[model samples]
Target: MPLDLNKLDHLIAVAEEGSLTRAAARLHLSQQALSTSVRTLEREVGVRLLERTSGGVTLLPSGAALVEDARVLRGVAQSALRRARRIGRGEREMLRIGHTPAVTGGEVSLLLRHVAVTDPELAADAHQRYPGELTAGLLAGDLDLGLCRGMSPAHGLARAVLGEHRISIGVAADHPLAGRESVALADLSEQTLVVWGRPGDSGYTDLLVGHCRAAGFEPRLERSTLQGTPPVTHVIGTDRVAFLTEPPGAAAGGAVRVLALQPPVFVPLHALYAPHLASTNRDAFLDAAQARASRHA
Candidate 1:
């Protein structure tokens, strides 16, 4: 029988939460509505998916089998959405684009504006990610276009220089260094550094740490964290210091101040895409990226 995506999503939520009540909360439905849907789903399939107990709902063997299928079905649907967005925009059969958050906000808005003026049919969907993930996704073929930082262009993909900017230091308004319009690593010698690091084996963390050492101090790296800006945000109120891209257009949360880095360290912003794209929109997308970068420059 053809399965409903909503039904599959509902079942997965129940399985993950281990209770109809909790799953209902997650799904933003009342307990009664969730229970009724679960019952209806079971009736449709002629099986008992859950057994309610004092602890909560427990999925039966039949439900367990279907829940696994639910994940696969959802993945297929997301791919379909991406593909539809790609084709609808007048691009080719498929185009997956990725870029770091730095390049994609105002820069992205500008790109879309250009597409409206120029290539209305260039239907490319852009995904935002960090430096390493964007590159890894490009190499893995799940992504067709990418914007990355720090890494040099690889062999298989064609690259163009978008622009360059420095990674700045972010701290709380009351912090000692916040008053400085620009700063050097030596100026921060006596203060605590709230650094984001690759806790285990993250190559990105290693890159940032190496820079810290060059500045003449070892950072008190945030522990047990994955790569992202939250660790940087956490250090704001404390003695810790967080690194950032200078002159950031819009604060990710609109609360932090973007500092200027003195003796500006240049980081590459690249526009990457699969060399095989047959769509005429490839150059159009590059044009969009260049225009966007120019606006920032």
Candidate 2:
């Protein structure tokens, strides 16, 4: 015969509270009803799962062992119930999307607009985080989808490139190459290159180094954190140049100039998510983001 999980839950409640009276009150059932349920479960399991005392009750060794297993089953049952309820009201279901600084522009707004039109029943919420945080959130169930630049080989996450941006050089306005329309990759051989990202991120670092090496010289690489315009600050004060997709604060009086690189190198923006838990909303949003990105590219 199949075991009744509700009875198992009652048993767990009784064992945890150490009193049938209290368990009955907590479960909103009469004391007699709760007792009968426990008795039925004990008989079904063929052992006394609880020891009665004047003050309360305690679990027998058998009961103690079964309590842990029962808790697991009860948790699973509760989770299933919650998911079912959410599915029943599908229009209110929410998908949590996360992104790094790289994806906080028109592309995401366009994706949300598309979802509003195409998948009206689904709602999406967005959060901003660093690339490393985005990946961690995606794997840990904190985020349903993430827009980031790199992947973790260890996690083996499923990802797609949303779009690629051509990398350009950022230099102080007074720098020699800053006045030029575009600069050759070989010209950067003599200038120090600054790159900024999260502490452990090596994707952009590798891209910068590889491009430089391909141009017949290794770049003099410098690193910076994604703090308040530190990469721009470093470039403005000295001869160092930085690789940038846009001027960090050009509109706000930052004296940095963004120059296109000849024979352009591209950096890809990626969408990382768990394949096992993929949903229709996620797939649709990804498709919209890809289309928007292509238009910008």
Give the best candidate by lDDT: 2
lDDT tens per residue, model 1, 7-106: 8788889998998888999999998888887788888888898878999988899998777556555655655676678779975554457866445344
The prediction achieving the highest TM-score against the true structure is: 2
Each prediction's total of clashing residue pairs, residues at least 3 apart in sequence or on different chains, is 6, 0
Q: Which stretches of candidate 2 lie over 4 Å from their true place?
A: 1-91, 101-123, 153-156, 197-201, 226-238, 247-251, 291-297
What local lDDT score does residue 241 receive in model 2, on the 0 to 100 scale?
88
The alpha-carbon deviation from the true structure for residue 140 of candidate 2, after best TM-score superposition, in angstroms, is 1.5
- Residues 1-297, model 2: lDDT tens digits: 677988988988898799999999999999999999999989999989999989999999999878766654554455456457778877455678886655545446666786576566768888777666776566545566887555442243578887876777888878887678788899989987776553346665666677889899977777654443433455775677887666333511557777888877887777888664535678777776777667776
Task: Tell me each candidate's RMSD, in Å, in order.
Answer: 9.7, 11.4
